[model samples]
Structures are given as structure tokens and as C-alpha cells.
Target: MSPSTYRQYEGVKARRRWITVGLVLLAAAFAIRSAQFGNPLIHVDENFYLLVGDRMLHGALPYVDIWDRKPIGLFVLFAGIRLLGGDGIVQYQVVATLFAAATAFVVARIAAPMAGRIAATVAGIVYLLLLGLVGGSGGQAPVFYNLFVAGAALATLTALTRPERNAWDVRRQGAIAMGLIGLALQVKYTAVFEGLFMGLALMWASWRTSRSPARLAVDMALWIGLALAPTLAAMAWYAAIGHLDAFLYANFLSIGDRSGAEAKELTRRLAKAWKALHIPLFAVMLAALLEPWKRWERGPATFGFALAWLGAAIAGYAVFGTYFDHYALPLFAPLAVTCAPLFTYRPYRFGLVAASLMVLSGAIANAVIVRKSQLKRGHQAEMTAMVNAIRPRLKGCLYVWNGDPLLYHLTGSCLPTRHPFAGHLNLLREHGAVGVDQETEVRRILAGRPSVIVDHEPTPRDFNFAVVAIVKAELKRAYRPVKIVPLKGSRLVVYERVEPK
Candidate 1:
């Protein structure tokens, strides 16, 4: 070929690659745009995370000043975003969008060698679309951590496939992969399952390449240590501050103390998630089972690796025993890669059909959520009104008993107690789970005489009635309802402390 013609062809290929990346990012932004900047009530968990992060910036330590079980790394992410600019709601949304896009890009990269580029790109887009259906439309933990896990997978895949590389080179790649897994662990401990799988896979690859058993054992130990480094660093910091026990309990031990949901409730959640997510689930199963074995470019080994990754993700989701829809976010990337070949299988195009169904269903589900937020005035106007009302009256602090925890950050008011997340103190399932007495925490918060208190009426059925009764009694005694904000099928009543005669 002529030199100019070769350069021109390369240029076109580069342009097409950029275009494909742009498309994936655009899909992620579009899918998650509904819950960006002003929609603080999209998910209560993120709201609290943002609040804890904001407070952390002002010298409040998590597990010490603001209590929750989320790893400190997640809060550090939010705090870092808050450090960049205002309020941090928009910043975190933007960061989450980028993370989602990057994760999808990694999915495409992992699948492109096995499936054609077109098929791989479709897999990435399908992943972004499926996220909204699985409650990952906003800044869920998986949204951030999935990117790390995907990177680890990519690194491990590259090392496994390149057996001609020197032993040191392979070890280096293994270390990088394990380090990424360690970072993921800090975002959510569930990444451990995937990390474990990838670590073993790396060891197997080394052994297959004729490494000695003693060397393999040493390599495994090094990789495991690398994977735990981030968590150990975090523990060391807490130990220096004399709060290691608090960190230990919140990060490791607290989950076991919580009560489990009733079997019926757990089944109901699992059924609901299954109903919403069956199309993608079926697509994953069909692709894994029906793909022509001879067509895979990397042969059965690559396909098996992807399938094992998916199994690890499923184990991560199931280990917690709670089947919340968002808990399934870890599965999307591996599912996408595992199902990519279906997009290019001769005349079937089953992947395209599944993608279409997923996009349509996901769009409809997100539309309903956005419309409900709009109708209830919970996204911007309602929250703004509540914040304005409470901000002016805040002489001491703001207590969010049953409403959005974002109120603490928005109102810029001090917290009444360390347990700001309502469920930790109010949910029957968390009666003794939060490493503190629920009733005592409620009393302590009320005794602080917060300037404004936010509570939701028609309490949720699963709330601890004892804690609810304590808050209600105190509200009646020393606080008067001042502002009522309507939400979806409920009201957020803001109360001001009553002055003595």
C-alpha cells in the first residue's frame, strides 16, 4: 500500500475509535442525567454519603461524628468532589457519569478481541442502559467501584493472554490488577469476591507458564497483600486518631449485628428485581449457552474467564443476603462482556434484540421515576423550600429524622447526633445493628434541641415503632410543625423548636 493511503486509513480508524468512545459516554450521561444536580432524593444512600462527605470536610469524622457502614473510601470520594466545588451534588453526578462511561469503555475493550468491535460497542451501550433498570441511575457505590473492578479484569486478561512475556512482566501486571481490586474494596467490600477470582486466575496463569510452586505461593501472598493495602492504610489512619475500634465496627462488624428482613420481604424484593431485569438476565444466559464455540477469537479460555467473572459478581451480590435492585450493579459489566458475542452471531443478532428491549424498558422505568419526582416536587422545588425554611430557623442544628439526609448539607446546619442516617436508628432491621442503642440515640438527638427537625408522616411499615414514638413524642413536646412539603405519597413536615413562655 502507498504511504499516504496507509496514513489515511490509520486516521480513519483513529477517528472511528474516538467516535465510539464518545457514543458510550453520551449514552452514560443520557441514561443518568435524570438524577444529576438537583435531585438529592434519587437515592437515600447517596444523599447521606454526600452529607457525610461535606461534614468530613468540616472536621467531622465518619464512624465518629456521622455514622454508617459504608467504607471510608466512598466518603473520601464524595469529599474530594466537594473539595473541587459547590454543594458537590452536581460534581459527584458528573464523576459518576465519567466512571460509568469509563467502565463501559473497559467492557468494550475486554470483549472486542472475542466479539467484533461493533458487537463489543453494543455490549458497552447495553451495560449503560441496563444500569438504570438496576437502580444505578445515580451515584450508587457500584457506579464508582465497577470501574475499578473492570480495570482489574482488563489488566488480568492482558497478562493471562500474553504468556510470552517475561515472568517479572507478568508479576507486575498481576500486582497492578490486585492493587486496583484493593481500591475497589474501599469503595465497597463486596469487590472481594471478584478480587479473589482474579487473583486465583492470575496465579493459575503463572503456574500454567511453568512457574514453580514455591514462586507461585510467594506471588499469591504478594498479590493478596497488595489487594489489602488500601484498607490497611485506612485502618492505620483511624488508629492514629484513636478511632480504630469505631472504624473496625462500622466497616467490618456492624453488618452482622443487623437483623435480617423477613423471608417474604426478601423474596418480594428478589421477585421485583427479577421482573424488572429479566430481559438482560435472559440475554446473558442465552449468550453464554448458545454462542458457537468455534467463533470465539481467544477460544474457550477467554469465554470461561468472562463467565467466572460473572459468577464472582453474582456471589458478591448474594453474599449480603439482601436483594435490593441496586445491589446487582456489579454484574452489569461482566454480563455485558459475557453477552457481547451474541450481537455478532451470524443472522441471529440476539444481542441487538436484547439491547433494544433493555433500552426501551430502562427508558420507561427512568421516565416513571423522573415523572414521579416532578409530580411530588421532591427533586428541586420541594427540597429547596424545605432547606430555605429550615436554614433561617437554624440556631443550633438540623435533624433529619425521616426525610432526606441531604437536608443537613443543604441547610449547612450542624448535625444533632452522629447517627444522621434515619434507617440506622429508625428501621426495625437495624434496631441494634448500628453499634449504638436506637432509643438512646433518638433521645440524645432530641435533647440537643436542633433548631429545625424534618420528619415524614405515615411512617414506613418497617421502622422501629419504639424509636418513631420517641421522636414523635419529643416533637409534640418541644417542636411545632412549620412547613409541610408534599412528596410521593407522603409529607415532609418541618418543625421549629418552641420557645418557653
Candidate 2:
């Protein structure tokens, strides 16, 4: 081929590559656009995260003023999003969409070498589409943290493929990967299992090139320290502010103290998650059992790494014993990459069929989930009505005892207590799990006499009845039922304090 002709061809190829990436990102945004804004109660966790983040902007500390088991870094991300523009919900959703898209791009990049570009791009799109099926349509913590995990995997994979020219270059890449994992840890601590796997994978790669045990040991220690640095820094900041104990208990100890669901309930949840996620899970198992490396010469190391990452993610999800479908979010990225080769393999056509089923099933499931979520939580009109009803009656702080915590943000009312998340204080599983005693905190919030108290009728089956009893007594003594805003599935009962005549 002529030199100029070859150069022109390469230029066109590069532009097409970029265009494909742009298209993937656009596809991600379109897939999740339905749930982007004006839906405050997309998920209880996100609602509380947004509330905590907005509070932070006004100088409220996380563990000190708003409590949750989630790492502080997640709140910081939301706060940074709020700083960018209007209501925190829309901004965070946009940011999460970007994160989901970026992670998909990385998924494509990782799979391209083994699977053809077309197959790899399909893998990326599949990742985005499946996110909605798993409650990741909005700013779920996994939606944000998965990008960091994918980036770390990409870094590790790159280091694995590169010929050992400079040992330091490989070490540098490992450091960057560990740093990314540390950041992911801040978003959600479950990233630790994945981080540990990636760390060991990097060390294994280092050992291959450098045969010195001492050097490997030093490298391992440095990577572990890097992975812990972000969490330590957060703890140090809390310590400096004299809230270190609060930080430690909420972030670490609280999880252990929490009670687990009954065996039947847990099994039911696990089975449900499996039903929703069976496609990807089955694909992962097929890839492992088939041993794709044996059939494709170029796939041994990459497939091994991807499979191990998927395993680590599954371990993380199962470790807590609570198999909420959203916990499977971290698995999607690695699942997509691991199954990329299936799209192009001609022998069994398993990958192609799986991909088609996943996309089609995921789309229908996502639509139903979004519609139900909107119905159950109410749309913008319903939210506005609830807000308006409570705002005027709120003479002081607002206490969201058993309803959407987003009211705390939308009503522009002060929080009645650090435990703004209703489930943390109301659920049977969290009776003594949160850093503060549930009964004492509820009493304190009641003593403060919040101007408006929001409660939901037909309380959850697992509610802490003792705490509910105290709250009911207080409402009877000092509050009067004012408005009942009917949601699709339930009614939000707003109570205003009785004024002394």
C-alpha cells in the first residue's frame, strides 16, 4: 500500500473509534434519561445521599450531622455535584450517567483485543442496558463506583500485556490502579474485595518480571497502603474535628451490629436477584466452564483476569448476606467484559444468543421497574403536592420518620436529627445497629418538637415496634394530623404541631 493511502486509512480508523465511543455514551444517557430528574424517591439510599450531600453544602458533616453507613466519599461526590448547579437530584443523575457511560467505554476497551470491535461495543451497550434492571438507573453508589473499578481493571490489564521494558513503568501503573481502588473504597467499602483481587493480580504480574521476593513484598505493602490511604484520610479529618468515634462506628462497626433477615426471607431475596441477573451470571459461569483461553490463543490472561474480577464482585455481593438486586451492580462491568468473546465465537453462538436475550429482557424489565418506581414514589406533581402541604405547616424542623427522606431537602427544613434516614431508626434490623440508639434518637427528635412530622401508613413489616410506639405516643400528645397526600401505593401522613391557644 502507498504511504499516503495508509495514513489516510489510519486517520479514518481513529476518527471512527472516537465516534463509536461518543455513540456509546449517548446510548447510555438515552437508556437512563427516563429516570433522570423530578423523581426524588428513585431509591431510598439515593434520596438520603442527596439529602446528606445538600446538608453538607451548608456545613453539615456526614457522621456528625447526617448518619449513614456509606463511606463519606459518596456524600462528597453528591456535594460536588450540588455545587455544579440546580437541585441536587438532576445534577447527580447526570454525573452518574457520565460515570456509567465511561465505565461502558472502558468495558469495550478491555474486551476489544479478544473480541472484535463490534462484539466489544455490544458488550458495552449491554452493560448500560442491564444497569437499569438492577436499580442503577440513577445515582446509586455502585453506579458511581463501578467506573473506578473498571478503570483499575483496565490499568491492571494494560500492565499485564506490556512487555517488561521498565519495571518502574509497571509499578507506576500498579500504583495508579491501587489509587483508583482506594477512591472506589470511599464510594463503597465493598470495593475492597475487588481491590484485593486486583492488588494481588498486580503483584503476580510484578513477580513474573522481577524474581526478587523482597521487591514483591515491598510492592505488595505499598499497594495495600495506597488502597487504604483514602479511607485513612477521611478518618483523620473526622478525628481532627473530634468526631472520629462517630466516623469509626458508622463506617465500620455499624454493619456488624445490624441484624440479618430470616433465612427464608434472605433466600427469597437471593432467588429474586438470581432471576433478575441470571443472564449475566449464567454467561459468567459458561465462560469459566468453557475455558475460552483454550479455544482462543490470545485470550488466556485477559479472560483469566476478567473472570477473577467477576468472582471478586460476586463475593462482595454475597459477603453481606443481603442480596438486594442493586448489590449486583458491580458485577455488570466485569460480566460484560468476560462475556464479550461470546458475541463473536461461531462454534456455539452462545454469546450472541445471550447478548440478545439480555438486551431484550433488560429493556422490558427496566421499563416496568421505572414505571412502578414512578407510581410507588409518585411523580413531580405528587412530590410537589406533598412538599406544599408540609412546607407551610413546618414552623421549625421537619422530621421524616417513615417516609421519603427527600422531603428534608425539598421542604427546605432543618433536620430533626442526625439519623434522617427513616429506615436506620424505624426498621427492626436497625434497632441498635446505627451508631446512636434508635429509641433515644427518636425521643430526642420528638423532644425538639419538629414543626412537621411525615409518616407513611402501613409501615414496613420489619419496623422496630418499640420505637414506633414511642413516636406514636409523641404524635398523639403534641401533633395533629393535617394532610394525607395519597401516593400510588401508600399515603404520606403529615402532622403539624398543636399550637398553644
Candidate 3:
């Protein structure tokens, strides 16, 4: 009640808040460690990212020397890791845990206003636990990008709602939010849709306070441009190097060029993800919409904001249409935020308890599934052994005819072609001289006279017919098959060059 007593109370509260952050971070490390430290290499995409990063650190350029659809910032992140020189995937996992913990801390802060401290703490832990449920546990783009998105969302929420703050303060917070969103976009373009949602929400807040249509339009335009600057900067960098068309084609047109799965297959994937994560997802969603409605008075706009944010996130993922389980990660933060109602509204306390148990248990279950799918399946070890066997014999570039980008990283050889993952050159999906161009590239790679090559035999339906023909013919003329290594589902053949081109 007195000034001295109140100051002491505030200091104690601050210390307690820091302690909670520490504990939640420990939980994050444990969650990611338990999920993937056992096998670690569940998905090849993460390794593909590392391969590009490693190449860039060695003075090779991305989109020119190494190729993928990943945006520039993702490459910079892994490139920094490669430069730092931590041993293998373990370093990546540790970084991912730190990001996860940071995200959890952000979620807690964002929710603290609506739900009490206890509920906010629960939200942080729940978000960390749910990260393990997705198929891409560690090193996934979402694992890193979600932290930025959550931070952006939190900053925007504060900008709009903190009535005590002056307009200049709110504007500063708005800039911070937009800046975070810009960074998130460079990590993954999927952040664009979520950025749109946050922008609309902030504009609504601006209009509410000022009630000026012209100002809202002008201000929103300025902020939107600022947020999109990273993407534009990337385009300019590539353009300056005369590869702007390459950047545009890779980031924009390449995905559209691929043939999508049939509706039936997409439906199956959607159903499986829904069954795995949606029990908790739906419970929280139902509670959020209905619980506030039953309140004698209309619930606060924060509740509505949570619902809309969750909807936008879900829609952001769904618009892509193919549901890899990790794509479900963005849904959890907003879901966690909205589910704070379970703690506040007595009627839905059961939702909190039920969802918490599901998420925590599912984390373990997902880990086991990944281990079985990758480790028990047995090819990863075999592939590693093959690369180890051939690493000594190869002197220059190593080409994996129909395999993953990780070949270069594991074997310690440079990639002969920027299109290291030969699947992209397959005849079925890509059009517009893709087939002709790839055949020419393959022959060009062969002309370099690499000491070693590894590839698999592709059936008619399996690969590009022309590329496969070129490979077979080139081997017969200039190279000899030295060893055939057996894997679980297929075989890998290593070729040694016998004669010059």
C-alpha cells in the first residue's frame, strides 16, 4: 500500500517472471531433445538446407551454385551455422530449442493480459510440447520462423491494445511488428498470409482510435511496404548478379510447375493430420468461439483477435493445400492464445486439462513414429556407410542422380550441378524446356570428368527418360559401375570414371 512496499512487490514480480522464462526454456530444450536427438535426421529437407548453407559459407552462391526454393534468409541462417563449425545436426537442434524457448516466452507475454499468470505459463509450455508433435521436429523452417511470427503477433497486439501508450509509442511498436514480419517472410513466404492478417488487425486498431479512413489507408500502405522490403531486397541482390530471373523462377514459378497430388491423396493427408493434432486443436477452437459468447457481457476484442489470428494461420497453411504435419505448427501459437479462455471461463477449464495432456503425450508418440520411420527403416545408416566408403575415392564433384542434396555434405565433395536433387529434373512435373535443359546440364556435368558418381536405375515411370538415357549412355562410354550397395527399398550404384570424355 505504501510506496516502499509497492516497489518491493514489483521487484518480486519481475524476478518471478524471469524465473518462469528460465523454466519454460528448459522445457523447450527437453521437448526438442526427446523428440529427435535419438535419430535426428527424420526429414531430408533440413539437410538440404544445410547443404546450401555449407556451400554458401565456402564462397559458393545460392540460386547459382546451390539450388532450392528456400528464400535468402533461410540460407543465411544455416550459412552462419556452417561458418561457426559446430559438429553436425546437434548444433542445429540446440539452436532450434533456443528458438522454441524464445517463442514460448513470447506466447506467455502475449497471453498474460487476457489470462492470469498461471494460464500464460501453461500456454508457453503447451506451445513447446506441441512442437514435438509435428513430423519436422528440429531444424524445420517453421521451427525457426514461428518465433518471428509469434513476436510480430505479440508486438502488434500490444500496439493496438495498450491504451496508456501515446500514439508515437504505438507507432514505434507497429514498426517493430512490421519489421519482425519482414524477417519472418525471408524465412518462409508462407508468413505473407499471416502478415496480412496482422496488418488488417492493426489497421482496425488504428481506425478504432483515430476514426480516420484516409490515415488508415496511407499508414497501412507505408507499413506494408516496409514489411515487404526484405523480399524486395533479395530480388535486387539476385538481379544485381544477373540471376533475378533465376530467383524469380525458383521462388515463384517452380512450385506451381510441380504437379500436385490428386484430391484423394491430399484428403488422406489432411484427415491424418486432423486426427493427430486436431483433437486438441478443435477443443480449443470450440471453447474460444462459444465460451465468450455465453458470457453475460460480450467478451473482449482480444478474444475475437485470437479467433481471427487462428483462422488466418490455419488458412495460410491450407492455401498451400498439401499438409505435411510440420505445416501445422503455426496453428498451435494462436490456438494456445485462444485457448487461454479455458483458464478464464470456468465452463471450459476441462478443455485446458484435456488439451494439455494430449499435447504432452503426443510429443512422445510423434518422436517414436519418426524414429521408426527413419532409423528402423534402415537406409540412412546404409547410405551413410556408402558415402563414407566412397568419400576417399572421390577427388572433385559427386553427382547423386536421383537422390537427396545431403550427398554433398556427407561425402565432403562439391556438387557438380546446382540442381543436385535430380528429382526436379524428372520428366513428369516440370515443363518449358525443363527436360531439354536438364539433359544438357547432366551432359555438362559429365564433361567435367568427376572421379566418382552415385546413382540409381530409374524405371520409365521413375525418372526423366532423356536424363536417365544420357546417364546410362555416359556411364557406358566414360565410366564403369564399381559397386552396388543394397538399401532397404532400393539399391545405390557407385561409378568410377575409366576414360576421359
RMSD of each: 2.6, 2.4, 3.7
lDDT against true structure, model 1:
0.83
Q: How high is each candidate's TM-score? A: 0.93, 0.93, 0.86
- Which segments of model 1 are wrong by more than 4 Å? 1-19, 26-28, 31-35, 348-351, 373-377, 499-501
lDDT of each residue in 384-476, candidate 1, tens digit only: 889888988989889889878888888877777788888888899998889889999888888878878888888988999998899888888
In candidate 2, what residue range of length 10 has the lowest lDDT sum?
Answer: 289-298
What's model 2's TM-score?
0.93
What tens digits encode model 3's per-residue C-alpha lDDT throughout 100-204? 788877777776666656666776777776766665466788878888999989888877777676555556667778888999999998988888988887777
Between candidates 1 and 2, name the one with more favorable lDDT. 2
lDDT of 3: 0.72
Evaluation by lDDT, superior candidate among 2 and 3: 2
